[model samples]
Target: MWNQPYLETCCRSALHRLTLVGRPGRPDGLKDGPCLRRLEGMGLARQREDGRFEATPAGWDRHALEIVPRKSA
Candidate 1:
């Protein structure tokens, strides 16, 4: 199961584009930490040779599913 930290982690989700891990001057900018490393290990995200991080296809799908609220009766 996904933990709060994982769900709350900052992400930029778009239909046609993947996530960029860090942002300029953002307090929540991606840090080189365990969470990020875990994401990469799961193949949900990747760190480029240039040290930039981006979301993989699986990551994109996960993010999309996360954003949509499930209907309740």
Candidate 2:
């Protein structure tokens, strides 16, 4: 589920935002709280002791499929 690139991308983006606060140590921002929790629950992401969430190995294995563009007839 989370292995999908699309999901991983979303998780990465969320993590970036959470860490951008520059507070240093533990993420307490509510903006990413819910999304992070959900990602953790889904096993796509995990929170480290440092309070930062990292993508799991499984999350990297999934790939998101994209629709190919058809050539003009």
Best-performing candidate as measured by lDDT = 2
lDDT on C-alpha atoms for all candidate structures: 0.51, 0.52
Tens digit of lDDT per residue, candidate 1, span 7-57? 434432321133443332112134534455566676767767666556677
Q: Which stretches of candidate 1 lie over 4 Å from their true place?
A: 1-32, 68-73
- TM per candidate comes to 0.51, 0.47
How many clashing residue pairs appear in each of the predictions shown?
Answer: 0, 1
For candidate 1, the per-residue lDDT at 56 reads 73
Q: Candidate 2 at residue 37, lDDT?
A: 69
Give the per-residue lDDT of model 2 (tens digit) for 23-70. Answer: 352364566677676667777557778776654544333212222234
